[model samples]
Target: MTAVHLADLLTLGARPAAGLLLSLTDRCPLACAHCSTDSTMASAQSPGGPFRALVSSFTPDCRPELILMSGGEPLLRPALVRELTASAATAGTGAALLTGMFFARGGGRLPPAVRRAVTGLAHLAASLDAEHEREVGRAEVFRALGAALDHVPHASLHLTAVPDAAGHAYLDGVIADVRRRFGTRVPMLVGAVRPTGRAARRVPVHPPAGRGATGRGATAPCEFAHWPVVDQGGTVYACTRQSLLRGGPAPAHLVLGHAARDTWRTLSERTLGDPLLRSVRTLGPVTTRERYGPPPAADGCATRPGTPDPCGSCLALDPATADATARQFATPGGRAVEHTVLALAAARPPHRLAAARGTLPRYADLVELGWTG
Candidate 1:
């Protein structure tokens, strides 16, 4: 098997150079119990100036290939969305939005500039989970879908699920319902729910003892290690989870040395050389036990089958845990490359997963042995 390197993966177009998950604003109208960002009515304020600067700085810094705009609800700042999307497009970046579909129905009453900006986006991704449906309502979901379809030809549906007897059943039904509703018009992606933030507060964190959404009993590998996250405050982290785990700290501004020519180089080097970031770049496949075991108080902490710890497997809210997981998998050898390939390959639409048997085996072999047809 040939080992794939991060550099080669980016150049070959198998992976993006860096995937930027920018939080446009933290204001969402809904107050779902499972909200991962811990967003609420009070925390919905926008970091306008700092966010603008971060986006501006990001454009020239190797220009990430994929930029995902998200927040408590990104539609709140229609104008900013437009500006960010336009900037990304101008810089030749492929952009997407992670939204709750709350604004999709009314076209978000966006300002003229923001509307124009959204129209230019490559795609809009809407969240559809049981909780989302309960809070936002199905009618609103259709309305948002209609709005999105009217604007962007590519709108993806992101479905998050947990592992449990009843939860698994609900997930299966959700997948069916999504297919029945959107069909082939909207692409869909499913993932496990990470325990963190509001979700951690509301939902119990635990891993599925048997076959589960993240490739059955097999652990899902962290492929986002090389990616860097730039928050609204211009604070950069190695990944989104890291940014969240750190409580959203502001990163030091890039430095400029005495030599005029060295200014940009020095700043860029410093940005890339941060120790916290370096730690993230070195993360790898985190053991399930490490994440799920009881807190430090427990003696001989370990996870047992059929006894899932709700806090361990959920990374949706905790940026720090996410960063740690990424760092654990960022091995220098072929392991990281293999893990990434497997992760991407495992990400399939519901139609594919339903039709395909032995997908997990093929994915595992492809990662461990580099098998391809």
Candidate 2:
């Protein structure tokens, strides 16, 4: 089939922007323990220029149907939202925001300009996990949720479920409460803790189990194979996990060409003809066998200095070991590195499925405390 035909099929049941995850900025207001972006805003200030440039590049031909603006907190850069929303609207794409809702409460309301911008978009997703609640304050989150409800009618709440009993309980309560207060209109998406960012240091990483719909249960075919990530640094990758693991190197790391400069034909040829993809198809089952082997020890970088061995649920488990393994895969004959990444992405459950499937009732059972609905 043609590439356009393949892209449409891949996104058949996916939500808006189902194929890509764009990191607008690494900066965030709250220092949540389990952030996937590993964002701290320590990088450059505003991504408006890069984002606008990307939009301009995609206009007329390659505009993505769904665009998600994520960061430390997207609302922190209100102007970026305005620009992004306008660009997406002009390009006939839907726009969404993923944030911590830090500014939603705390006497900080969504500015009228932001509200106007949001009205032009499709959806808004606010994070409300335990760490986010602690950093941004729950009362403020609720207020922010209410405020978001006021402007964006299609707003949804995301509650991250970290490993361990307490984390699970916290997520449960948050979901229940959100459902009670907002009903199904503002659905809740439960995500598992990923081993990236500061969370890699603070939260313990465990073997992927019951992490999400796919992680805990069945392994679905990856839909992200055709979708690519366009990071704020102007780099593109086949997947966000690859971008993070490779530290944003050349597109060759993920076998993707520059989205801004390369034509879709060039990108398709390179991606489909990539040795990495071939190796993955060959070695995926073998690596799957090794993944269930004895877990690594808790010493060294696996556990941050002065911190307890949170390795049980930690994503940084054996960074040295994993790096070594990755190197082996990178070896001339092994190609095991490529297989390992595919295995990880396939193993890790995606929280987006619940949101995409509109399964809010399952999440509502968790957050029962102080539920307003």
Candidate 3:
């Protein structure tokens, strides 16, 4: 079952930003201390009811370029993975899945169902890091990936570590090892452990520092808002920030709509065109906050010194403020700037997107690893 190269996706840059992040379940077998999705054996699992229905709604002309299935561990629901990938394939949409490799602890045998699910995939990205290494040995993961290379056309590594010296050293060694074994056959996306989900208890939230801001302290446009995330409960969000989508009633601004009630066409339209979302994507949350928000000093944001947390300001927006944002971006100059941002991003190599988003600055080059170009 040959599939598309992972580099192909990396090369897409956020241009059209036409991709979907569909979380299959919130249940994971591994207990990595740094797990972001906070997965556990007892975590909530989502059946593919709305998830399937949404994918089924895709038409060839309107479908996303790619559909990325993730999870607490997507492989746990192998049948659903197979079903959705098959559905996506019919629409000329590419599909990929990410996992922590729970089945590879010992001899690393791919379960029959998992093998079936992985067949015909565009790619499979396996997670490995200090915590994952402890939960599943490095040897086991390597062996499992070696086995996978035979069935999948493209495979890659999704690694996470503390963004410090020790973490860098660990990733360097693993990347070297993967190359020694696979000889550039696999690329890697190395990232810092996000302080969300379970890890939040131990690590505080901090977007990477040194990100630039404008003269008035507005932040870089939030590339995060460009994609839509479908959480386990079928709730769709402008981005996958766990805090943004938690529980009973979501803030109206962040909630795009539920997957059960909204089709992919509807979600895509809302995500790409919603006034608030457009502002978040074009000018970034912090900039939008300042350009249309209360004086920074009055909000206590200016008093903090340095650019305020981008997402924090974004989350603070009200309907009226969002409307103000809509009108701002609707202007000719604002629209030109927005078009320039998208054009510049699309014009550059995709690795730049990886760097801006959070792949360690040093390892971002590896994003295009093994590409013939």
Local distance difference test, per candidate?
Answer: 0.48, 0.51, 0.77
Report lDDT (Cα) of residue 293, candidate 2.
19
Cα misplacement distance, residue 71 of candidate 1 (Å): 1.0
Q: Which residue runs of candidate 1 sit more than 4 Å off their true CA positions?
A: 1-16, 44-46, 58-61, 104-117, 207-221, 242-373
TM-score of each: 0.63, 0.65, 0.91
Q: Which portions of model 3 show Cα errors greater than 4 Å?
A: 204-218, 247-249, 295-306
Among all windows of ten consecutive residues in candidate 2, which has the lowest summed lDDT? 1-10
lDDT of 2 by residue, 151-265 (tens): 6646666677665678678876776676677665565556666656666676555432111111321123233344556566656565434423344333233536544576434
lDDT of 3 by residue, 98-131 (tens): 9999999887887788888888788899999988
lDDT of 3 at 255: 81
Give candidates' CA RMSD values in order: 9.5, 9.3, 3.4
Give the Å shift of residue 113 in candidate 1.
Answer: 8.1
Prediction 3 TM-score vs. true: 0.91
